[model samples]
Target chain A: MSQKSEGGLQEQVAQLYGTYVDMVYRIAVLYLKEPAAAEDAVQEVFVKLMHWLARGRLQEKEHIKRWLIVTTKTTCMDELRRQKRQSTDPIEAGDFCSLPAVWQSGQGPDGERLREVHDALMRLSEDCRLVMYLFYFEGYSSAEIAGMLHMNHSTVRGKLRTGRRRMRILLEEDRE
Target chain B: MRQEDIREYFRSQGPSETQKDRILAGVLEQYEQETQGEFHMCTKTKRSVSKIVAIAAVMVLTTVSAFAAVPEFRDWIGGQFGLTAEQEADLAASGTLQNIQASASNGNLTMTVHQALVDEQGMYIIYDVDSDDGSAVDVSLDDLQFQASESAGVFLYSIEQKVLETREDGVTCMALLTGLEDLSGQEVSLSSCGLTCRWTVGETAEIQKIEADLTGKDLWTGRPYHVTGCGLSPICVKLDLDGAERLQDSGFPDQVAVEVANTDGSVKTIQSVGSCGKETEDYRYQMFLFDEIIDVDRVQAVYVDGVKLN
Candidate 1:
């Protein structure tokens, strides 16, 4: 790719850094379930972003976001594949259940509740967790989310219902 | 805990600024390592670069003008929202459309509020984002939110649909805000960070409401549905559907296609974008937005999936 001037490249990076860095990190954490791995994924995605900027392929903010979302998800998926291939131990649900160390290590006012919620979230399947996150947290309707995630609308609703029910049961079990 | 609590829990978790800055630094370092020698070696002089940029700008402008002249504001609303020309005219004649000129700026980015089309259900805000410093405008409908004036008592609104079109200099966005109490003639503020614009929602178009409680089976899916409420105007039809828990069934259809039987025995189809189903604790609430507005006085009966519910 043809390179932009160093100053121009820095400006683009600075503009996107504050806006999307946390989002990229959070999405990576959600998918990879390991802060260290997620951080590596974030770096990879940003490096790819630099290439996009150098190529002048991105025209606007919306395009950048769409690209980031797809790229981050793909990066996490590739990491998961690599982990599965590398691990000698059996790949199981418990293997991917770690909440970020920040939430697990620190106990604030809402720490216990946060842990409970995070634990329940980690227990759900990856698809369910993503659907639930987009629906409840991001406030996207099932149809809109289906378009974003490229799933059937019915499937989005199904995952949401299943996720909600499972989270409720898990939280209740934790309380007991 | 409730769904809102879960949302809050996730929302509160993210990497801190220090981590973000570290990641950015790493990215920049990697970029420099990857592109160092090639970048400086290929760099053009400032004068030649500016000449090329100016030529490219003129060519881009010519191409933009030749291929895609920005549609007039009303035409944009009609095209974006799928309204017909007659429907657009009816909305204007009924005083449902208002021209609004409100704007807010943050640094190089400026968000301008242009016009609003209001109905009994909600309104569509037409706006555009431009960057004065020639940077790419990076705003989305999710970034923009509406809050009623303090006196309006904490009203809630949902963006049902958004249409974005990229233009030469900026991005134009039309957002349909629904699921709110009547906002007619009420002062509301829309803001995204430092960019804020306040305007009064103009007088809503006078539309007819048909209180519907008709239950029928969908012929295509053989599933049952209830029409809880409906609104009619010369330009649009808003129908609310309650699936009564059948929405959870696999293969449940979203779009409840409606065919309006006119009084003169002609049938005019009220095209739907699709079924927008939002599940609640007990029922599935589906909203049907018709693309074409029809003559309300002539709509004798409305049929869905071959079942008449009028």
Candidate 2:
């Protein structure tokens, strides 16, 4: 690439950093479950980003969100692979169940509620959890989610509706 | 807690803004160590078009990146040009859109549809039209169009398609058939029916000049283009490429991508340039739609060599 193009690439990556750094961290932590490991994973994602740009693979700006989330998940899985845990076992193996020390470490009622809700969300089945995150937090449609996750559109819908139902039940139970 | 409360909590928990800078700095530092460039934060310019819009309104900005990848952003584009959200939903849910891989074989030319992207922008069929006999298809905007047999949806017809690449077997390109219409639950087909000219690599582009409001240079040609106006409301860019249109038709180079920086320090990338209006004899008028919108007054469209167009 020319120097000018490389400069543009640098600028685009910098912009991506400001916009997606936190989301990338949250996504990495959602799977890695540790701030330290998640932080490390965040670094890995951007490194992958440099490669993605170098190859001229990104066609449009809208793809950054999906690319970050998907890449973080894949990179986290690679990290998990090194740990010898079944990388595909998102919720079934109780991987993300425990809330990290810092998140629950906040003081008072709001903190407790945050911890409880976080725990409950982490405990939902993998498909439901991912569907819920992509839908509510990331703002992806069921159709877009299906395309990204490589699942049927209807299945993504089912998981999302069911995910909400499951979360509602868990939160309602926590109140009682 | 309600689902929204959980959502709020999920959104709330993450690295702080300062930490974001640090982590990103560290990542780039590591990348530099690995790739070996003069890596530093102060020198880099971040892509900020969507970020600025995102900060002002999350709901509006999220859906663009959250959906279309640009072509999927057709509705947002349509909504700008007078299409309703309900209409967009109906078209999306119609499911009448067809995806056929059928091939069109002429004596030395063959056109095949790899896939079709249907959204608010209508149907863009990415196809391969190649000639083993080394025959070149006319790259003019007027000579190409769609021939719909059966229809359930609207079809705003056009013959202009941007040929992205020319491969040994065929050329990969995208054709925008309509704006208000779509292929959703409809029967549509595109062919090089009226293609008369054999436009080869050495062929010159026929982009003429048009009248406009604002004036901006074509950077490469040093010729001023008549830009009617610049808007941040769904951000429309009208650039009349005089000598530069040659690259679009032939596989030559017109290298015209820009980053518009707002006064508030946000940058937006302008790509996938297409025509929005008629052609002029001395200029090839084209427009690029940026994904996000800015407050027009504050927009500083930064070009190469610090040429700012507002």
Candidate 3:
């Protein structure tokens, strides 16, 4: 890029940095759970965006948004993988149970019941958990999730079915 | 059990409006910042009609009239700045031009200018900042004025006409300033959108505050803008009490010592818990505290007493 173009890109980046720093941090916090790691993830994503812009990519606003989320998810997964490799200690079970239960209409089960459901969901594999999150929490359809995660539609459907079944069983156990 | 049940549960957990506003502001700002360069570039190319026609006329006239005929042109114009072919094409397409303002400071003084035009195809003004040393420079917009109709957010400004037109862009009303080239480079660059310009003068000053605070009912969005605080460190539980005493007193095994480790390898201990009861046999307990606030959906692991329960 020409020096002038480079300067322009820098100005835009400064603007973006001013605007989105917090949102990126929040997303990172949501995924990484470690403040340091979340900050690192957010910074890394922006740096990556800068690099891409320098390379003449990141063509649109939607592209940038998608890049942020996808990169954050990947960063979180990378952190998880690194911890898994270095540590021999068993992983903690569900922390969702630690939260107090409060219920409102249109909200699913009460907190206690939800915790039970979450605990059961935790028992499933990580892939299953992710599929469930994308489908349920994110309000993504199986097809949409398949595209986002780059998985087969059938596989996404199967995972959703299995996840739902497992959750039902767990909820039933809670009732019992 | 049902999808509705799950949806309700999740909806109940949705972030509060304040949090959403903060997040959305950040998201929108990032989006705007990232794309603004291209937008400016496109705008610049579109608005440079007179310059383009002049340049083209000069190029054609020089070829036909002979280079020597325009000898005084070099002295009269000093130099000719022509857009690259790609830039020209981009200009033809977008039909818009944007001017940016900036400020610079020497040790004893500061000067501001609205320097460059940009178009969608990505072009900008270049100057040698280091040509004169001991001078620091910052760029901003000034005297950004706009008017909006009752509806529409489309802002139209004619740099040559000195007219500002504002219209609705869907839901938001946009303010537009035209004929910005008439303003000094410094003022144009430092101009703020949506509100009055607040300039702070000092030796070590940074930004000239341009308050873009939305008015009246628009404040329902919760402050036209807000900054998100830094992420918090995960909460830690310290177990300083003797496990043996509590476990023995509670009829629990002293051999069972509980340890907690975060994903980052930071460790803590869980002391004074009784021995595994009958219920412990059927159900396992894994305690994992997040190192920071997180969306519940994004939480990947929760460890309990140093066990990979998840």
Q: Write down the C-alpha DockQ for each prediction.
A: 0.12, 0.13, 0.05
Q: Cα RMSD (Å) between model 1 and the true structure?
A: 20.6
Superposed model 3: Cα runs more than 4 Å off: A1-43, A50-56, A88-90, A96-109, B8-310
User: Model 2, clash count?
Assistant: 21
* DockQ, candidate 1, vs. native dimer: 0.12
User: What lDDT tens digits, residue by residue, belong to model 1 across residues A1-176?
Assistant: 24454445555666676667767787787788766677888998888776656545465786576567656765676567556546645334345434455556647667777777877888887668777776776677897765455444567788988888888898899788
Best-matching candidate per TM-score: 1
Which candidate order results from sorting by TM-score in descending order? 1, 2, 3
- Candidate 1 residue-wise lDDT, B123-176, digit = tens: 667887787877666666567778875335555445644547776557777766
Report the CAPRI category for model 2: incorrect
lDDT of each: 0.62, 0.52, 0.37
TM-scores computed on chain B for all candidates: 0.58, 0.33, 0.16
The candidates score, on chain A by TM-score, as follows 0.84, 0.79, 0.64
True contacts kept of 1: 0.30
Tens digits of per-residue lDDT for model 2, A1-176:
11224444556676677778878887777777766677888998887676556445453556656767766765665565444333354333235433545555756657777776786777666447767877888888997886565444577888987777776787788778
Alpha-carbon RMSD, each predicted model: 20.6, 19.4, 26.0
lDDT of 3 by residue, A100-164 (tens): 34521215446555556546666776556667766776667887665444344677899988988
